[model samples]
Target: MIGEPMPDPRRSIIDNLNQQLDAFFGAGKSVQVIPSGVSADAPFFGTNSHQLKLRAERDKLAPAVRAEAAKGVVASVAAKNLRMHVKRVTLIAQENGFRFADNP
Candidate 1:
């Protein structure tokens, strides 16, 4: 196996996002880590219009609805001790009234 390309040890952005989805949907399976500098164009499992609807509706919601949604997300994160650092960071951001760049 010498000089053969070894698998990347780092996770990719898509994998991280899928893990978040899995976690949100009750963590059925773990995401396989893809190596850095690798490209994976595969679609995710359990991806559906409902997820898209939720994402779209989030932006159209009023400020109060958004705040309530943030609270709900924070409450869920607080209730479950998610191992991902990004999830914890998201919880922190939610508590601090900040959001991911994708959010409105």
Candidate 2:
């Protein structure tokens, strides 16, 4: 495996996004991550129609909803570091406007 090609980081991020969304929204929800390169056409991470709906619903709730969502996202990414070569992970909670303590 010395000369094997490294996995694409974008693909890894997309896969992580899908798994995290499923865990947050339950098994049957449709969630996908579309990766576009470092170009202007790249879409924001969670701006799909289904995600828009979920965000709208969450927005209607108390401020804690946003914090919880951020925490979940950060936790999901951090978990991936266990099996993958994650260089860094950062979690920013919008409610308190503070970042999580980095473990690395």
For model 2, what is the alpha-carbon lDDT of residue 41?
67
Per-candidate TM equals 0.22, 0.25
In angstroms, the error of model 1 at 55 is 1.3
Compared with the true structure, the alpha-carbon lDDT of candidate 1 equals: 0.53
Worst 10 residues of 2 by lDDT: 83-92
- Please write out the lDDT profile of model 2 over residues 46-69, one tens digit for every residue: 777897775565345424434533
Query: How much lDDT does each candidate structure score?
Result: 0.53, 0.52
In model 1, state the lDDT of residue 77.
43
